[model samples]
Target: MTVSMTTRASLLTSLRMMVLLAALLGLLYPFVVTSLSEVVFPSQSRGSLVYDENGTIVGSALVGQPFVGAEYFHGRPSAANYAPDQVSGSNLSPGNATLRERALQEARAIEERDGVTIGEIPVDLLAASGSGIDPHISPQAALIQVPRVSRERNMPITEVKNAISSATENGGIVGQPAVNVLKLNLALDEQARGMP
Candidate 1:
């Protein structure tokens, strides 16, 4: 039995629809997503890098690293060993011995560097952030290290605290107060130059 002309035409139309849908869903969709990502979130799409005034890329504000010297305000602990590409926090349970040991070591190091007792150490300073890529430090964490940063820069502690306060973002809705480490550090560098 031969099919009617109308049925043949409908079959061809269905095949064309399949091809168009495949191209749109399989290819066009991904391309559009990538383009939109680049446009809408340029910094994040490009890895969230922090750049210096001269347009040189410094480091990413996302990941925490060891900034042990008194001149710099340190960030939260990271299990990535400061490796940006390997960003992660230790997935240890609360009673994990490794976590306990690391916390103790971090507390000791901060105390030694700041010439303060361990009791003064902020919890954020000793504990790793969940994402290990937190761009901001808690306000308490920033304030705790202010004296050391001021002493190393030979600037007044009050001035350094003021800078911290200026760089901080206040609690909005449900968020806690936080200071962007990159911005704070850059401000310190600028202040060293006596720039207004």
Candidate 2:
């Protein structure tokens, strides 16, 4: 078998190009972006962690925590069960029997818990967000839970409403307003501490 020099040169050139491109895309690109993000958005770059008054890390503002207690505001229904590593949606189609059954069960539970009719329950509270770790819920969702949280926490309805108002993020013209469940619950705890 006779090997041509041109073929050998072409193989060497291709190998060299592959290595250069791989290093640039896989290594250099990630390094530059991470470094820039750290400098430009320090808190967000660090996962937007939420801290307690004792300076202990509690949770990330970006991820939802499951709060089943009556005293705390609950976030969206997480198909992943609020596990970041298992982040995913139910992936069931709208007409899926399992999805409908689950939604019906949740609606009935919400009706009992929040004293609201099934018609009034916000869809966001029934359906899990695509990421299954949404930290925020619609303002309507938060409001419906206010009575239950206020009753369980022994805080006045007015004060709980105020807490919801404070924790609610106005989406402005770009998006609909949302309430951060974790922040609202933490703030309620702080308010309870000060109450006689």
Model 2 clash count equals 0
Q: Give the runs in model 2 whose Cα sits over 4 Å from its true position.
A: 1-9
Task: Mark the 10 consecutive residues where model 2 has the least summed lDDT.
Answer: 187-196
Local distance difference test scores for all models: 0.82, 0.89
Positional deviation of residue 129's Cα in model 1 after best superposition, in angstroms: 1.8
Off by over 4 Å in 1: 1-26, 40-44
In TM-score terms, candidate 1 sits at 0.78
Pairs of residues clashing in candidate 1: none
Model 2 vs. true fold: TM: 0.91
| Deviation in Å, model 2, residue 64 alpha carbon | 0.4
